[model samples]
Target chain A: MVAQSTGADAKNPIQVIERMMKLLDVLSYYHDPVSLKQLALETGLHPSTAHRILAAMGATGFVERGEPGSYQLGIRLLELGNLVKSRINIRDSALPLMQRLHQEIGESVNLGVRQGDEIVYVERTSSGRSSVRVVHLVGARAPLHVTAVGKLFLLEDGLPALREYAKRTGLPGLTPNSLTSLPALSRELDKVRRHGVAFDNEEIEQGLRCIAAPIRDDSGDLVAGLSVSAPAERHSANWAPLVKQTADDISAAIGYVKPDQPAARR
Target chain B: MVAQSTGADAKNPIQVIERMMKLLDVLSYYHDPVSLKQLALETGLHPSTAHRILAAMGATGFVERGEPGSYQLGIRLLELGNLVKSRINIRDSALPLMQRLHQEIGESVNLGVRQGDEIVYVERTSSGRSSVRVVHLVGARAPLHVTAVGKLFLLEDGLPALREYAKRTGLPGLTPNSLTSLPALSRELDKVRRHGVAFDNEEIEQGLRCIAAPIRDDSGDLVAGLSVSAPAERHSANWAPLVKQTADDISAAIGYVKPDQPAARR
Candidate 1:
């Protein structure tokens, strides 16, 4: 299935595909168009090899010639990316990331979304090794002042709206640690705003604590929350960074971009 | 079997890249996992050839084996697509599509976004052969009731909000044909709701008309408008479908999916 070393790759081996991926990886590293020489050096492919492959990809729009001899990643990747983003379910997208986090921490990871005033558990992954189980089963619900994810949605509502929410919901509590007063809820939400994450502090159950981070969509609007639930003794602040990262990864899977990008926000 | 490339592409093209593209195209065509037999049949590739390539792509996550030997498009495309979508600007994304629409219709194409109560023209392409040039400059602004793009924003506001908008603006008129009354604005918005398109009918200037369709983001929220502006004599209902399609295309570039898919609406 091999042709002359320069001709049709319709039958080329996995090695060619790996070389193509390396070239793509290098192209993505440069913010501007990259020179053929630099691309070849970065990928460790011969200049002629890089040139021929780049030209082939150019034909298929995997790369585009920019500013003469330099090249940039093409719009074709974005087009394909959009198709993938649109076809995937958020729950399905979040599960693997959640599983990775769970396997790392040996704790339960939960994905929740705001439904009315309550945060509804949409998906979760857990390591069976935990001695104390947390009740983050699928379809469970908790009020805004109690769960870490609920507190995030409250903060997103802003202060005045948060005050109104407190008035409406009467700052309900599931346990002694819950923020049952408007002042307590207000202070906790302010911390949520400052830290860009929220904590349940054993509010949803007697001995279980949770740490949650916001998950946003393309327009930078918070659409869901990613959190880790564990026994209060086992839960640590160290979980915050990983939970936040996994949440961000899920958001990116759904087409989110930070405002600093040229894509900007809606 | 491989892609039906012409003789022009037969010489010195990367065969693996061509085969990879063909496999991706075939994978994207089906909503579910495609068997080795079906993929081979679809791409005219041998089953062994298809399996090996799919295996390679799976290693890179561009394809995933689903339910044994059957294959489906992988999340790697989504990951790369997110990278592209997040980095691209709306104006940058819209211009190429706008130029294509202009070339097809031989008229001016415009991209506009709502600012306060007005739609400010953000980008445009014109054939230069127009008998009269339209003032769709980069920063041109028009009231929500007087321009095709503007009416779309008004329609998105719904009836109660539209009523408030009419009250707030007093239904200002720039031309005799403008929708100056609440009843008129309401009726026009109703048509916009029904047809999912809007019109100006020379309301902004004498003999100049425009047709606009809504542009939404990945969340299905209206973010901008895409339209065709030309002399009233040349404007027709036929432009509606193209304008709508182009807007939808731009939406797709930014990670939009129609409601029929499993991704569902937020």
Candidate 2:
């Protein structure tokens, strides 16, 4: 039915809805309050159009007016986000093991899941004594080709899907070491498949490194990634086995059984 | 400008937005998927009106169609939630100290802030070894009078505001020990003001108990609450001094200085 409505329909409700979504997408990119003019410019909508949509959204608590004409994503979204996070039981199940890993390694440990072309950090244990802050904050995101957790998901996607992803995102680079070529990223994913680990060596941010292992669900499908992140100077390949073991432990708790290893480590 | 519209007009974009918000509000109340028929019935909108709004929302990824006819809140909300959660710098400043408190007390530690009539848990450190589950998950919300952190907010609201709150919420009781009477609640707030700590003695849950201390900002405004939670049997009043110290430590980290304490602890 929606497909049937074509041509110049300025008063179309669907077009208004589309414009509303574009405004929200723009707001999601900003951490601070944004003015109506900025939002209008970013979305390519007229100032009056943006203002009307924003006012409607404000009434619904999806957008909040701040200093005069500036607006922000509302608390209602936080309420909804909490509901979504709570529904995903993997976060609760993996957090204990993530804590244990943080205690042992004295480095930041993160749990992330794939959301489209990005990876979202759903849970994390911070490196307490480090003066330098770890960049993999909970709820933080990075492109699939740049983050260790992201590569685990990319490895699950075959060469064709990965190539398509590269084309779609243009392989945006975050640091000097980020893989900007299809061949380079493909080779990295190959290692991830064989070694059961992925690395972000000063990739997403300078001086930071991450080692990630895949988390499996009851059906032995990759569900999430558990990554141990540290400064590049302190990162070691020695942590791979321990990280893999912890990921395996979380997978087991979620009813995943290794097809090859009859007696998996608990 | 929105106040100019009074009577219903079919072509009015604001009325359509109101219907859209009504659908979302209904969806928020459910943890499981809801059918279109049920949503229409709950919102008192025609099925066609609800369907049109839901389809628009689904396009924007705010709602997801599940199990053919059922719908659930989408991951886009989760993405936006992460954005909002990460933007709040207090969660970052309080976390390391909360981790320290959790280590010292061997219980779950939480950070919460007031949002309208409820308190939202912004950050928490799980008690790793405990079998008992902590109910205050990140992004979770509860009524102002029901949580230990919430009571600290009430203590700041003064007598008149507290009375208005009681009348507004009807002092809804969750357990036998809940403060359902206005006088009883006032007395509890009085104690909280004097002692600088608030206790939830099985107020929200039967076996769970929480003790909370107020977190202040640079302007000396009460900004958030820091709480330690444990089972009723394991809870101790001795943790009060330690909790207060940690709350004060976090306050100091955020540039808050008490007028009485000239030397703030680093």
Candidate 3:
């Protein structure tokens, strides 16, 4: 009887799976909780069908029922996400250092990695006192051409790849200070490579400034970047050395020894 | 060939889906990263078949390939987990208060909800300095007969259901202090109901003491329980009032009001 409504194509397994995945996609769009009726309306499925799909998802721990009829993604996903994140040693190793840096600097610190054309924040730590001022949550993504961490990640990819990426994604001006030309960004990246740090002078938000440095893997391959964000007034020119020192400490913690360092540094 | 191996039952759609789900189950067993060869060996599948399943999972964002042949759960899962945790508002609303309580009491604070016959911790905050400990992680489950939160949830389910549950599961002693007899636990539950609080005096772990209070929803239905864990040394006679204040703050935050409250209390 369940198959009665379908004509010739009713039993296609891939289509069934696709429909289920689409239902999950609809549920994932809302950052807040969503009701089954809202899911039904959004997915253009009958309410009963949406309820059935959600029930199936709940059974598999893919979704959890919220207050009554509402639902949200479940902790089974966190178990999986943690597995992926644990392999990224840079993120894991940098976390404690990031926490210490945030405490010392009284600012927010983030670890970002390039994923496709965007930079994804893999980790973040904020001092408990200043946490309210820094609203960027972990897992949020930002454009590669704007933030300090983004620019540091881009610089790590080197000039040729950076040029192609900028050309493809377009170097649009996010703020008055944003580097909108390929030449200017290339020059900035050179400075970043030489100094081993990048700066964001209110390029993302007017009152926010950041300093970032790359984190390299055992092979000296650029793996990720770390950055500290503070209000512009607090990020005076004198703070650069302090930020660089914190970044170096984090880099050393992750086994990135500077070429000039003695072997005893390990 | 794929169809021939399934014999006459080859056309059963649910069996095919179950096979796919079984692959996921095999994947879930590895908390540490898993290699493709290990996965294939564990699942008793041909390497090609395991690879195919993993590839399909990767395409759907359920799993991701780690270094070379290793595979891990993806960020997509974490995104979903965060969504579920957000919808389970008791965890979010109670976490800050739990942290503050932990800071004040210099111990561990836990938030848990009844799931089937067990209690699953939804949130936990701890004072890093504490030597007395509890192993309650988010998504970790504990037996209902032993834990303070578990007993609170069991008591919240009322007398008849409690009798049925205890009859089915039996009150097993986790530690010497744990209530093992049905009559003894029932009496304890009664006491807890009258006082609006519960205590675990080394019932779960020796030398550890905990005080717990139930949390309720706007409908006045018991939703979860909050608890503070401290060393017996710190849980001296005078600690009850401080624990009660923390519990009342959390309960009030979650929309629970005392039954005898004046009309202006809201």
Clashes of each: 8, 0, 1
Model 1 Cα lDDT, one tens digit per residue, A1-266: 33233333334447777778778877766656899999888777888989988988887767778566798777666555556655767898788889988888889889999999998999978567777677779999888779899888988888899888888888877788777888878888888888888998988798988899999875578899998988888879998989888899988766565656522111
Give every collision pair in model 1.
Answer: A8-B15, A9-B14, A9-B15, A9-B16, A10-B15, A81-B81, B1-B44, B1-B45
Task: Identify the runs in model 2 with alpha carbons over 4 angstroms from their true place.
Answer: A1-13, A90-266, B1-13, B91-266
The prediction achieving the highest DockQ against the true structure is 1
**What DockQ does model 1 achieve?**
0.33
lDDT of 2 at B107: 88
DockQ-based class of model 3 = incorrect
* TM-score for each predicted model, relative to the true structure: 0.73, 0.40, 0.36
Model 2, B3-51: lDDT tens per residue?
3332343344566676776677667677778999999888778788788
Q: Rank the candidates by lDDT, best first.
A: 2, 1, 3
Please tell me the TM-score of chain B in candidate 3 relative to the true structure's chain B: 0.61
Compared with the true structure, all predictions reach lDDT values of 0.79, 0.82, 0.69
TM-score of chain A of each: 0.69, 0.64, 0.61
Candidate 1: deviation at residue B163, Å?
A: 5.5
DockQ for every model, please. Answer: 0.33, 0.17, 0.10
Score chain B of candidate 2 by TM-score.
0.65
